[model samples]
Target: MLTLIQLILLLFWTSVGSAGAEKLYHRRDRSDVRIVHANQARVITDKHAAEVFLSRYGFIKPVNWEEAQFEGSASAFTDDFLEDFGDAVLEGSSQHPLRNPAWDGKDPDGASQSFISALEEFQRVSGLPVTGVFDGATKEAMNKPRCGVPDKEVDRNAAVDPESSSSASDTVNETDANRTATNSSVSADSFEDDAYHLNDTDGFDLKGHISNNTSVNGSHDGDMGNTSASTHQSQAGHRRKHHLATLISKNRQRRDVSERGYVAFSKRLLKWRLIGEGYSSQLTVEEQRYIFRLAFRMWSEVSPLEFVEDMRSPLEDVDIRLGFGTGRHLGCNQRFDGTGQEFAHAWFLGDIHFDDDEHFTAPNTGSGISLLKVAVHEIGHVLGLPHIYRSGSIMQPSYLPQESSFEMGWMDRKAIQHLYGGCNGRFSTVFDWIRKEKTPYGEVVVRFNTYFMRDGWYWLYENRNNRTRYGDPVTLQIGWHGLPKDGVDAYVHVWSRKRDTVYFFKGTRFWRYDSENDRVFTLDPEGRRYPRPISEGFPGVIGPIDTAFYDRRDSHIYFFKNALVYAFNVGANALARGFPKSIREVFPAVRRGDHPDGHIDAAYFSYTHGAVFLLKGSRFWRVAGSRERRRRLPLPRNGLLPHEEVGEQWFDICNVHPTALKLKR
Candidate 1:
């Protein structure tokens, strides 16, 4: 028999184990809830219904039932089915055979070879078993709610295998190397681990087929008739040859640039709006606009592109227009199927229309369709991304269950970057601001914030989050009261046992900051007046320094001006002996001839990484730190690492539209 205390402990452990199991079960359950809306198309009940579903979604060419026969049950085909099918396919492709009714009956083996091949292709892409029959599993997959965009385009000539892309190997190698090198020094939070591989050679081409009114529609229709038994048996011999030929042709053309293409906007900065006439009835106008803004901002975070909501601009002037409507709504050429599998559709490099019949809701509502996810996916199409079949990709044709912490995956980021390239910008100053704070538990904590300034604006980067604070780029005057309106050249925080002070420099002047008061000091404790010259502050250092940073390890301030670095000792209030050194000598490049030799922008020592970074133009080089020394490698002390794009290291430091400079958090 167990003691009383032991029995209590056993009960506690059992409950804890059950709770962990429940959490795992909950996640698995959520993933299984793929369909958002309750009223999606019903399951395919018979062979006739399967044929119509397949035909409508660009599987087999629209069949002329009167002239053709299949091995399945014979049922009368309707003209309405053919007309709806024609409209749906024609919205995206002009070359669809159904566009010319005369060619519909030309293929005698359409019910056999073409039908089976289409079924297999659909099954393959939908992640189902390619049995080439109307099975129960296929019926279930066909009934799931998916994007209005077709899974397969009638005009798409080739399929690019993402595994074959060169970038995959490069990305894997770089990630592994970075992980191995920084494992001891960097926190897991600083690195994004989710990997979504993409094809590097596939470019989103914006030059082709600039249609002003093209749309991609998704819908379901009634059942159609089947062909006679003899027709299917007669064509069974050709099935293997036809399927093999199709696969070979696709593989052969995969690398052909002309075969793989998409549309994108020509310009970086684009305007968008939620038209008043088509706002969602389910959400308030403010809620709708906020969701749209966030969707656009998500894209802006990864690319150089910037989006500004233009409510007052003429509809035509806006680069992209978003709206919500039901059947035959929004002046779109295509009509939406009321609240079924098709939720919304977008024109390439054009407008987006959401089906109002669907239950669109705010993010993380847990039950309804996420308008934000839908909006982001649709906007991707407008920006020229096709349906990516990879799991975790935002561009997937079918909607996955809402993840509360869903973000744009790496593959999606690379795909968009392939079109517009990464975000790049120059910073006037970059520094990590350290301060002491008291917690509620009466514990003292040392905290720091990283900031980047350009021109008159500044952005506070949340190091833990690895992103800038949303709605950043606030003016310097607002962030640092009594500072120059045009922005500062550098910031240096000098901290030691006896002294802890902060200084901001711009042009020939420097200002002392009172961290306690959060403003520039007119008169310091040392009786120094405001806007002191560099010569007075540090006797041997020159005025108008390019950039400066205080090194905690050496207790000296290194100021970069032109090609020289001046090291000033804070304790002595003078330049150190052998102070002036060539920038290259002080911070030698690890790679030969890869240094930012002169005219440095900002020298920042990051507390998080425990290293100094030299920023110039759009690139930055990291200086060897204590971690590198501890490894006992052959790397030189203070040697500069290979230059990397600043945008890649510090992500989403993007500018917002001038009109949206004060966006609400």
Candidate 2:
């Protein structure tokens, strides 16, 4: 029995509660602002703002006051505009400022001409209309989220000069421009954060080390926007800068390579670490380190370099130190703009700083900026790679949203290899591991995995992913129990209607393997002990074989030793007639002098590609298969195809440093 006023109050409160709950739900479902910052929401509201933006990002240079007045364009270049321009550009290129005088008002019309040319260059790189005017499309692109690294590292006189340069519009078509514009609009308007989110407040000065105990939960005390807190932080930053200058003077003899092409590390083995104090609040410590390990491993897969995480080493000894920071967080010379626009920047052969203000997510979370992608791109910069302006390249200056399935592109691989050559090493053996499994419905399926062995270590290559397992180059003793401590010479798998057996060979001895048990068989059904001599197993085959593989079609084990091949018939348990032939006669090269003629490393019969490959050193040659036999220009029987580098086909089968062999899980 409620009164009318009481009933009305109850309904009103209920509606308010319901609305609040609904707002929370929508906020949780909303995607993060990956590329655009809220602070830059209306930064380019007018033409004057646009000019300031251009000048800040290395697009337009500051005009000389005397020359500008001589050209009668002094009104356009106000003192405040010039001052802001100088401050922004100086901040952007603190390490390497653009010193070319050609764009700094040398010609009377240089100021106006340079402005138009810079606009055209910006539009061209951004995939927008090549109109030199400051249009709406160009303004939108400038406001979008991008890497903090300056786009034009060197002079663009040849590229932007109207008289000398080719038409910028010739590269991008109308369809591409329209699609880019639409995608950009969708990214900016629909996906940005609606509310301010507090970032990790861990106080770290620019000194490349972290002060962990200074904060709780790795966060600072006051709000980042607090005026008093920022003032105190600014003063603290000044002290760190003075300390950094002292360190630079102590190491004054160190030669710095300014050119990107010559900027690679002189050594192959490099050390990297994420500063303890600079861990991101968005991800756990393990998640951040794992992401970094994978990123470094990706580069190692394509090149001869190897990366190891060294936690015990001194800060100065570490080759590359990475950390997350807000404005003036790390003792870095360059400051991060709060959220949006510039996400991260890297110093050549030095440290990397990420803007923690941005929402960074783990790999494949499908919401925020991908920390892994950003890491790989930054590592490229540290390794001396300049920003590549091509589609699908990870080194693009602007931040592109991650695809569902992304990988290191071809251009990226080749570019890195050009600086540091490919991964080159000899292998003891290489083979495909085959097994049979049944589905829940009792359907039998045959599966196989590829492995490469060197010394006592082996790599499990994921054919589907076109790379080795994340922490591969595992020791053989751990993977293949009861095998030789050093490594096996070859692996042979026999599959026939009457029998299925697996064998491992080392020196003069051979061991029978029980595939079902994942280990070598001590005693087989026939009462034969393991480690029987090769002479006893195959009567005609010699000891110390180079490599071997079983051919399913012929039901024979082809044993390779020196320059001859012994085709041993499994059913008859004897060498095939007219076998033990010269290697050249058995596997002829399709092209002259293009084969692993003799003393090969391994012979693999691949079920994936349905062919046989002869591996030697770092190269591999594919034997003629059924498809080759049916070709219009059919290859000769057992003809070896042109040899190609094994790394080119099987991506990223790299070795980890001995110290980093056992990961901390």
Best by lDDT: 1
Worst 10 residues of 2 by lDDT: 182-191
Q: What tens-digit string does per-residue lDDT give for candidate 1 at 93-135? A: 4333334333433433344656676677668767888888767
How close is every model to the real structure, measured as TM-score? 0.63, 0.61
Window of ten residues with lowest summed lDDT in model 1: 181-190
Off by over 4 Å in 1: 1-141, 154-263, 275-277, 281-287, 310-317, 359-370, 389-392, 400-405, 437-449, 456-486, 512-536, 540-542, 578-585, 588-593, 624-642
Task: Give candidates' CA RMSD values in order.
Answer: 19.9, 17.2
User: Which digits, one per residue and each the tens of the lDDT, describe model 2 over residues 596-618?
Assistant: 87898989887778899999999
Backbone clash numbers for all candidates listed: 4, 8
Q: Which residue pairs in model 1 clash with each other? A: 69-227, 69-228, 70-227, 70-228
Error of 2 at 640 (Å): 5.9
lDDT of 1 at 333: 47
Candidate 2 clashing pairs, residues 3+ apart or interchain: 35-145, 201-220, 205-330, 205-331, 206-330, 206-331, 206-332, 207-331
